[model samples]
Target: MSNTKLVINYHITEKCNYDCQFCFAKWENPNEIHAKRGLSEQLIDQLASYYIGSGLQSTKVRLNFAGGEPLMLGKRFIEIVSYAKQQGFELSLITNGHYLTTQFIEQHSHYFSIIGISYDSQDLNTQRKIGRIDRKNNQLTPTELARRIKLIRHISPNTEIKVNTVVNALNWQENFTPLLDVITPKKWKVLKVLPVKNDLLTISNQQFEHFVMAHQSIAAMSAEDNDSMTQSYLMINPQGLFYQNQIHGSDYLYSPPIIEHGVEHCLSQIEFDLNKFANRYIKTINNSHFLTTNTNIEVNHV
Candidate 1:
């Protein structure tokens, strides 16, 4: 409900290097989840025009590229970001840090205002226990993650690097002191592990809070509990269709994936809580509000 503009969380790809245990995008055929496939240039253009018409006075829109490792698209991702820029939108991206090459870092660093690295633990044993290993030969250790953080800072001094940690049963009790001390990010977001269709690892509120409080001094920490987590974000699945995640029976329930249905129609079916979305962010980023009437419609942009 930011009066400034809209924020679009788009899952751009489905090919991921690391097989994290609790990955939400546990699709049957991940390789099929390419952004270009579902979101055609025509669709993107229509979306751009719709958003522009909707928010005439709004200054900018934030397009957040997420994944199954969004970087799998490589230069294509940069191309899309450039296209979005041409359409008058700011950009941000989330990555697993596996494909953070020096060349790519130097080339597309300025395309994103913020880049988030998904790092759960600093302990190798914990990482292994949680399936954070490369199916191929090379495994990404915590030291390597730290090294990448430093590399990002050294290369792109202006880009804000945020460390996104999911508090789960595997490493919630472990000390995060050493990791935080090594390479601190601009914003440290501690999100409670959300249950998807198949989540084997999870944690309680007490455990998550304990870990967050452990390293508050490391950076400006913002902790989101399950309830807030559900309502806070506008998440689009790999098929270019937005989804609202919540408990159904034993598994999770996701709304249907259809971009042509429009974001507003799908959002209304899910009864998305706009109030939570409006005030969810607690970082230093300047976030303001839109009138509730405008927000009630939410958005029809894909």
Candidate 2:
């Protein structure tokens, strides 16, 4: 790991308000660690002690709070990130933007280095078809999303904004240039839908390429296909265990709970390719120059 930051994507909860058909946050256990406050804090403490306290001055740990929807945790989510920040870890959050209310951004935006919102389509019908809407038929329209981004910029100017778009059959042909221009995010990640749960929404590599080509003019854009996605991320599930997607199928290979077996022991049970991770990290840094501000950290898995 060439002085790259360790991005531990902790899927704190499997519960989400939206019913996105392509969502891959599913795990075996419905009981997520977030429900158990003490256990959740314990996991955070262990991660901080091992990664931040390991005396590796060359690596910076970015604890990205992901979820079925992290913002749904509301005040509890704020407390978790606050604790992680105190432990010397850089914080980021990937939310669906449904619960990314003005109150939260105005009050807690300072807690994050980056805030990623999943915005797949600008068309309300497309969004509804993709299950990106809540039970009440509520969705984050482009106007609303742009409004939120403006608020973030005004309140937390230093905090980088990110937009995550999953390229699936439903929205691959749609042009996002107008939307991207309006939001003006620091980074716009276009990810090919993975077939972890089902291939119903998966698009061909060629189709995915078309979407990327159409938006090639976007300066802050990056695209990731399935091949580049697998075995590259350091993921921890809601059960407090290190896990990776199986190379061959939809199945996942999990380690013993990190809280119980220790980080080293748990990591040993999974196959994490350092080379792949380095490539992804380097690409991310290249795409977003703002990440270079803090680069003196040691190598640790996220």
Candidate 3:
């Protein structure tokens, strides 16, 4: 268990395509996110050092890039990915797959051990209802979802694919019958829609589990119920502030920015459970097909 690597859910940017109404990083206006976006190479270095230096000595740190959309940062996102890999860290990325291009995949596909794309439901109407539409000029089509999945697998062949389905009222009842049966992912993360303030999209334990069971046979499943989500990850918002989304009071606890408080201080502020962090990687890393050269990455299943 001491050897299990830490997984950091790093939100690289607030600017996202398809503004989900139940967005955890509830920006007041989605349009203003671009103006608010910033992720310096300096902060990126600090983040890498914190996890790499302070984490288990034998294990390589896994930085999972997420966002309003990490791909929205475009080339800069890849720059950060390169920097982290150079520092002896494993990589993962979460995107809606809207910006996956031939050039982008060819250049940056090797950096990530896993590339996750969010897919809430099989029904197009349900997707629209859950705020999975491009709030800007782009239209969200029914076929676009399937197209993006196939394109990603075609372009980036070796890297492990992971699908994130946030179980909510819109998607819970619908059958998830393996949307990507052709391009099977290494893991299917079935996460419950977190209860936030003024939140309407919610799911019960029964509902969340049912969704996971439906898709569990399709791939390795990481089913995080509300209780399972808390302290299971080391999460960094776009501002470089580390936060924990819990199943308790306020639903979240935040730390000072890694720039201001430093990584150790920021981690201490959150009371992060190292045990939980180790446990999370146990289920997902086995079948990752992760092609990193680093020998330090020990997949501890204990």
* Candidate topping lDDT: 2
Q: Put down candidate 2 lDDT per residue, 1-302, tens digits, no spaces.
A: 74788899999988899989998897757778878768888998888888878875334889999998988887787888888898888999999999888899899998999999999999999999999999898999999999998999999999999999999999999999998888888888888898996787988877887787787778887667787688989899989999998779888899999899888788899988877777665644335321111232222111
lDDT, model 3, position 49: 67
Q: Per-residue CA lDDT of candidate 1, range 121-187, in tens?
A: 8777887777776777465677888777777777778888887888898888877767766777776
For residue 225, model 1's alpha carbon misses the true position, in angstroms, by 1.4
Model 1 error, position 241 (Å): 0.9
| Clash count of each predicted structure | 0, 5, 1
The digit string of per-residue lDDT tens for model 3 on 1-302 reads: 55576677877677878778788875343342123434355566776666566653436668888887888877667767787788777889898777776677767777788888887866667777887768564543436666655666667666788878888988787766645565456777767787765467886766665665555455455666665566777787766677886656655788976777787778788857776556456544445221112223222211
How do all models score by TM-score? Answer: 0.83, 0.92, 0.82
> Which residues of candidate 1, in runs, are more than 4 Å off?
3-5, 29-38, 56-59, 247-259, 282-302
Off by over 4 Å in 2: 283-302
Badly placed stretches (over 4 Å) of model 3 are 27-39, 53-58, 136-147, 283-302
lDDT-best of 1 and 2? 2
Worst window of 10 by summed lDDT in candidate 1: 293-302
Higher-TM-score candidate of 2 and 3: 2
The better candidate by lDDT, 1 or 3, is 3
**lDDT (0-100) at residue 166 of candidate 1?**
85
